[model samples]
Structure formats: structure tokens, C-alpha cells
Target chain A: MTDIRADIHAQTGASEPGFGDYVTLLKPRVMSLVVFTALVGLLVAPVALHPIEALAAVIFIALGAGASGALNMWWDADIDQVMRRTARRPIPAGKVEPGEALGLGLALSGIAVIMLGLATNLLAAGLLAFTIFFYAVIYSMWLKRATPQNIVIGGAAGAFPPMIGWAAVTGSVGIEAWLMFALIFMWTPPHFWALALFMKEDYSNARVPMLTVTHGRRSTRRHILAYTVLLVPVALAAGFTSIGGPVYLAAALVMNALFLHGAWAIWRRDEARAEADGYRTEKQVFRLSLYYLFVHFSALLVEAALRGTGAYALVGIAG
Target chain B: MSTRTTPLRPTHELHKRRFSRNLGVGLTLVAFIALVFGLTIAKVQGGGTLQAYDHTFRPALLPQDD
Candidate 1:
């Protein structure tokens, strides 16, 4: 049977996709970040939720984010086929059909939104619905192919999860929630542009009009430095909010310094020198950007857990 | 002599894929049902409010700490 199946596969040259292939269509790595940030947002809020309710909220939020990812892959299958990075996605790799992806995305979007409304509150569900629309229709279908400022504007979709999580618990938006939103919003440019710096050809070949492609690498480096300079203050400002404390402030200070220094190094290096060193500084900054967000969010969680305890005492601004 | 060349039903990769998809859907459905049940229980356990509009003092609406 194995021999026969091997011959069948060799003859057909078709991918025998399994259930996992469909799961991959959801962009699980990105969904994990959505889950993490949403969970942190829910946990940090003043209102407490039943564990069951919180679990349901986080799961539905993850589902909503995954559905948007499926919609993005469905819409971008053409460009996914072009770029080496996304070329192996389920749709482009021939493991899934475009129409199937679209149907699944739409169906899951509906289910997630309605179920979240039932599980949490309408405000959270409404935010999730808008996020899906923003990512699928606004960003994926329109801005991604049309503008160089694509990520600049489109970063809102990724920034909204924590806000949704906050609304889920409190049935409203608050300043602390927006502070988390701003953290991700500002961090996105430097993070993605860093990836684009190293992966320039991929975006250019796909004609995605990324900053690195449209504005040129030198300008891209300058933008990275500018955004990093801008990001530092936004990150530090969170420490003054009700959710902030010594731990969060300390994490924000150290991470922002490292991030800003890396951006400065990237800005100082010339194309000739960057090429000589194989874009090491750009790549390092890209890797650091991941940890930078992780550390900030983790610090928020720590501060929330420490609330009302002696250890939670003396937040610089909260006090 | 038994006339058997291929098995009655030859195993195929498509069958495996189909089985996995069906299993995933089935498990997900079960999980969804369980969640709805759990959510309902949690909501009920949270204690219902006295009809705010009616303002009738329903003893049942109050927490049973006494």
C-alpha cells in the first residue's frame, strides 16, 4: 500500500493536504500573539470575569483573528504565489482552494463574532467584527497593494485585540486599553520594516510597495530610526497609566533603550556597509522587536498580578 | 481459488485527509457544545437581577449569604 501510494503521489504531483493544512490557513503564529495580547488585556482590566467567561473570550478572540488571517490568505493568494516567504501558504502551495479558504474565513468570522457576543459582551464582539473587516477588506484587499503607507495605516487591525479583550471584561474602552493599542501600533513599523530590509527582494518581486521597496532602503533605515524614536515615548507613557507600575516601567525603559539603540545602529550603517556585513544589524533589530513587545506585555501581566499587594506599591506615576 | 486481485476497498490518501477533516469538525462541534453549556452555567451562577424596570423585591434575586 505504501509503495502504491508513493507511485500515486509521484504520478499526480499533487499535495495530499491534511487537517493541519487547513489549520495553517489560519496563521497560527499570528493568532498566538492575538491570544496573548487579548489575554493580557482581559487579565489587566479592573473588572474580573469568571474563568469560563475569560476562556471563552480568549478562544473566540483567537478564532476571530484566525478568520481574518484566512481571509487575507484567500485574498492575497496571487501575491502569496509571488513572494518566497508566503509562497508555501496553504492556498499558494496547492494544499487548499481559494474559494474554500474564503468560505471558511467568512463562516468562521460569523461564528466567532456571534459566539463572542454570547460569551462576553456586544462591545467586544463588535470590535472583533470591525477588526476582521479592517484586515480583510480595508488592509488586505485595498491598502496592501495600493499604498506604501500600507502597514502604517493597516497596523490598527493587529492593535485592536487587546482593546477587544479589555472591552470584553469592562464592556467599554479605557485609556489603559488604548495605551496597549498604541504600543503595538507604533512598534509595527520598525518591526516590519526591519524584516523588509532583509527581505527586500521578496516584497519588491511581489510588487507589495513596502517602504523598503517604494522609499528605498536608505529612507527605510531612516524611517525605522524615526519610528523607533517615536515608539520609545509611547512605551514609556504606559508606565503612567493605572495599569503601570515599577515592573512595567523598568521593562519598558530597558527594552525601549535596546530597541532605540538597535534602530540607531541600523540608521548609521550605509547600504555598502550593510551589504558588506550581510544585513546583520537589520536582522538583529528584527529579532529584538519580537522580544521587545513580549517583554512589555509580560510586564503588564506582572503588574496586574501584583496589584493590591505590598509589592504593587509605589508605581512612579500611579502613586 | 478465491478471485481476489485488489482489496474490496483500497486505502487511499484522500480517505485519510477526509477522515481527519471530519474528525476535526466533529471534535470542534463537541467543544462548542461544551462551551455553551459551561457559559450558561456560569451566567446562571452569577445570579439573576431583580427585574430592574418592575422594581419588585424578589427575594430570590438577592445573594443567599443570610
Candidate 2:
């Protein structure tokens, strides 16, 4: 069966976009975060999964996350065009048609959810569906333009992967799963707020009503400090869970202390001082926040590994 | 008889992109098929054995008198 569209464009060549543009619409960086967190969730669960099943579960989870990203790109194409950071996206940059993105997003969403249900369990599949809906419809369509607390609420969509991953293994959610969810949920405001501080002009220009846009930068700074202060307890409390051990406690303590210091520094600064330094402190906090979550999750992974080998038992912290 | 010429000229850039797109879709489909096949095999073997309506005289699994 020949493609009539391709045949029509054959001779003169309409410069049809290549497949990589489709991949770009998936937002690979954000997909990496979803993959990592979900992988950690699956690996650290109490029950051991066959390696092949685990890999398949993670792949479907990632595809589900990517589908959500594509849907987000489809829905937010207008604002994506307006913002400098997202101006070159496939739809906005004219590489791919908006309808193409919407079709692909929808198709992939169905495929990922169905495949995940087949590969794992219905609960994980259902959660992926909800995550997709939350990001595409709830967050992108409604909350983003509706209010300043957008990311605070939208962060739940991102936070669901670990819970889904945990469910994939155990067939149900648990306290530890919620703890992981809380880690990302509490960390999101402080993390994105730092980026909003540095990228303040971008949000306001797009009229997305980021905390910095609706609330003043002073208030945004205060919110960042407040969230950071609140995030510390959640981050540290994971250390006492089944996933945590001495390694996690140590990492959480040091990282949370630095995080608090960074937040406090941002809180103390005035607009002129921040502008003079090119928002260096804000940028540093943002960078540290990236490492903060990765380090915490990695520490949890390490504790899980040590526990598996009875290393924690020697130190009297074993299950 | 009109000669059957290829619709897409080799020299055209769109032809190249079209080729790339087709190849990408082909590879992705193949990978998906492979993954599904592998998953089926893995699930059947490692996902626990399927208990049919009746196996080869499994007296232990048969319903007992009350």
C-alpha cells in the first residue's frame, strides 16, 4: 500500500520533517527524570522482579511518560511558541503539524497504557492513564493559565511515576511509595521556583502565571524558602523507611542543610542584588536541587543494595 | 506504454527524509514486536505457571469433600 501523501509530495519535495522531530516532541529530558525515578521505585521494592519483566515495566512506564510529554507539547503549542526556551519545539518551529503531534500523543497514550496493563498490572496502567490526563488536561489546559500554584499542583503528575513503579512490583501502593511521592511533590515547588527566579522574564512574557509572575519575586523567594524548609523533613524522613539506611540518612542530612542554606540566601537577597549577580545564587540552588533529588534516590538505591547483601545487618540497621 | 518511473527522485531531500521516517517507523515496529514476544515468553516462564481447568491428575489441587 503506497502512501498517497508521500506520492503527492514526491517530485518537488515539501521538506517533510524527519522522525527525530517526533522524538523531540516527547521532551526527552523530562522523560529521563521519569525513567530514573520509576526505575528506582521498581528496583527498591521489597519483592524481586524477574529482570526481563522489570525492564519491560520500566520501558512502558517511560513510554507512558513520553506520551504525556507529547500531549503537553500538543496542548501548550501556543505558549511554547511564545517562550524562548520552548520556541524551537517541533510544532511551534513548523517542523511538525499540530494535528500530527495531537495524533501521535493520543495514539501513544493508548498504546502505552494498554501495553503497560498487559506487561504489568491494571493499577500501574490506571495510574499511567491518570498521570497522562493530569499533565495534559488538568495541568496544561487548566492550571497553567489559571493560577500561580500551577506547578505545585502539576507536580503531582510527575510524582506518580515512582508510585506506579512501586505498584508494578507489589500490585498495591504502600507507605514507602507515598514517601517517594512526597519527596518529588515537596521538592518540586522549590526546584521549579528557583528556575522561575532565573527565568522570570520567560514566564511573564508567556503569561503562564508562574509564582514569580503573579506573586512578586520577593514573595516567590519567600515561597521558595518556605517550600525548601518544608521539603527537608520529607527528604530526611525517607531515611527511616525500608528503602533507607545510614547512607541515605547521611546524604539527606548534608543535602538538606545545603538546600536550606541556598534557600535562605535567596530569601535574603533584594532584586537589585540578584540582578547584579545574574541570579547566580538562584541558578546554584536550581542546580543543587537537581543533584539533591538524584543523590537522595541514589542513596536509597545504595541502602537497598546493601540490605540485599545483609550489609545493613552487620551494623544493626537491617530488617 | 509509459515507463514506470519512481515517484520519489533519489536526489530530493524530502525523499531522504521520507526514507528516514519510514526506516524509523519500521525499526520501532520491529522493536515493539520483539518486546511483546519477549514479554510473552518471560511472563509465561517466570510469571508463574498457568493452572488450567484440569491438569494431569493433580490430586492435591482437586476439590476435597467437605
Candidate 3:
């Protein structure tokens, strides 16, 4: 026990971390995506919210997302230290103590849930609380180390933000909200799989059961193509929903075609070719996936804007 | 008994910085929480214009005009 404590203490350096390190522990990059998607969900809803109430809801939701990040970092610090991509994270870098992270996470979780409940509605608050628990306890603790399907099942936590946002505005979940959730859920696998293909060594060293580590690269490649094909229909289908407009349809069509091409390129590559080219196709697809989600969400926002200006009515797509 | 002088421990600046920053963060969070709670209370009381804000905040909570 003393040896283990010493090891942990060493990993969490004796030097005190600055404010920025604490922010890093919150996984700001991931939080940004959560914030954007949640905002889109809230804005695209038919109901309008007071500016202050909307601001509070978004802040609380962002805090809930950050809370999940801190807890995940606290729990995964050991493996994080072993993975090259994660080794420099605040906890693994010895900048923040694991205990501090856990405390911050729990505190923020409580505050976010209660505040969101007060600011929005009980339903939105409940969803936020569930999302935090799902990510921190279910995904981080249970699934991450247990199975190769971790990303597949765990993607639900990330997918909940937009649903929660919709709930915040409308005080209920709807088919449209579920469609947005499904979009993220389906996008996660191919996106993470692409990263895994390029960073298989990190997962191998950390002994995490990522698909690329458990199954061979060939299998992982095929999985990406399969998920991408499934994702295309969902993306296109969303363009026909109430939120859908010509802008979204055009964006979805072009993006899905490019996404399919990227996945196909990846599927056709062998380990030898991939290694020779430094996993270029896989890396390109991974980057494209980021833009893919952002563009889709942005198109939704554009449709919302057009609706606000009555252009959607004139276009007869305001349903 | 022979007396030996112990070296003075050096003060770490990083610790001081972290302490102040964390304090600031703690206070900010507390203030935000207080504000949210206050808004909630005002909402529950049906406080004038604020009640309209609450009504719009959750339209499902209000009676809908079919």
C-alpha cells in the first residue's frame, strides 16, 4: 500500500498546478463539442427561452460535461500515464492530484444538475445528471477497461447533450432530439476507430480493449466502413425531419459522400500500406469526421436562422 | 549533546498561486450557484415579470392554448 501510494504521489507531482492545469483536467476540447451541440439543440427547438435562462442552462450543461471529464481523468490516470496521447494530461503529468480531480468532479456534478434543474426544468436536469453518471461511472469505470465495444456503448453519454439541450428548451424529449442523439451515437465509432487505427500502439501499451487492439487492423477498418454506411442514412434522414431544410439537406449530402469516400479509402488500405504512408488515410478520415459533425450541426443552425427570418416558410420547408 | 543547525525549507511559489486560483474558482462557483437558486425561488413565487420568464422557460409546465 505504501509503495502504491508512493507511485501515485510520484505520478501526481508535488508541484502545485496552475489554473490552466485544472481547466485541462476538465477536458476543454471535448467540452467545447458538448457545448456547441447542446446549444444547437436548445436553439433549434420551436420554443424560445429568455436570454438569461438560456445562458444559465448552457452554462450548467457545460459544467455537467466538464464534471464528467474530471471524473474520467481521475479514474483513468493510471492508464493515461501509459498512453502517449494521454500521458501529458493534467493528472497523468503530475500536475493535479487524483483526489482533487474527483472532488472537483463531484462538486461540479451536484452544482450543475441542481442549477440546471432550477434554471431549466426537472427533465433537463435529470438528463444532465444521468449523462454525468453514464460517462463517469458507467463508461469510464465499467466499460472502458472491460470490452472492445466500449466506444460503441459509451457513445450514448456524448450523444445525450443535444437531447438534454432540447429538453431544456421544450421541457420534453422528442423524435427530433432522438435523431440528433442518434447522429452522434452513430458517428462516434468510425471517428474513434480512425483514431485507434493510427494510435493502436497507445491502446496496446495501455492494455485498453479498443477494437484496433482486440481485433486486427483489417477488422477495425471494415468496422469503420460499416458504421459509416449506417451513419449516412441517419444523416440524410435527419435532413428530412422538421428541423431539416434545403441548407441541411445539401450539407448532409455533400458531407456524407465525402465521409463515405474517406471510409472507403481507409477500408481498402492494408497494414503495410498504412504504415508506409503513416496512416494518412485514417488520419484524414478522423479529421473529416470532426468537420462532418460540425457542418451537420451548423447546417441545422442555418435552417433555424432561415426559419426565424421566414425564409423557410417561403421555401415551404418549415414543417 | 552536539547541536546541529537544520536547513530552512524553501517556499514553493506554485503552491501559493494554486491556492489563490482555486479560491477564486470556488468563490465564482458559489456565487453562480447562489444566483441560480435565487432565480429558481423567484420563479416559484410567481414574481411578476420574472414569472413570465419562468412560464416561457418551461412551456410544458404552463397550460397550452390548443
RMSD of 1: 4.0
lDDT of each: 0.91, 0.89, 0.89
Q: What is the per-residue lDDT of model 2 for residues A61-153, given as tens digits with 9 covering 90 to 100?
A: 998889889889988999999999999999889888888889999999999999989888999999999999999999999999999999999
Identify the superior model by TM-score, candidate 1 or candidate 3.
1
Off by over 4 Å in 2: A1-15, B1-8, B47-66
Which lDDT tens digits does candidate 3 get at residues A1-319? 1454445447555656778788888899999999999999999999987766777888889999999999999999999999999999998898788999999999999999998998889999999999999999999999999999999999999999999999999999998899999999999999999999999789999999999888889999999999999999899888888888789999999999999999999999999999999999999999999999999999999988898889867867545
> Which predicted model would earn the best DockQ?
2
* Each prediction's TM-score versus the true structure: 0.91, 0.91, 0.86
lDDT of 1 at A32: 97
Fnat of each prediction, in sequence: 0.59, 0.59, 0.26
- Residue A74 miss distance in model 1 (angstroms): 0.4
True contacts kept of 1: 0.59
* Model 2 TM-score on a 0 to 1 scale: 0.91
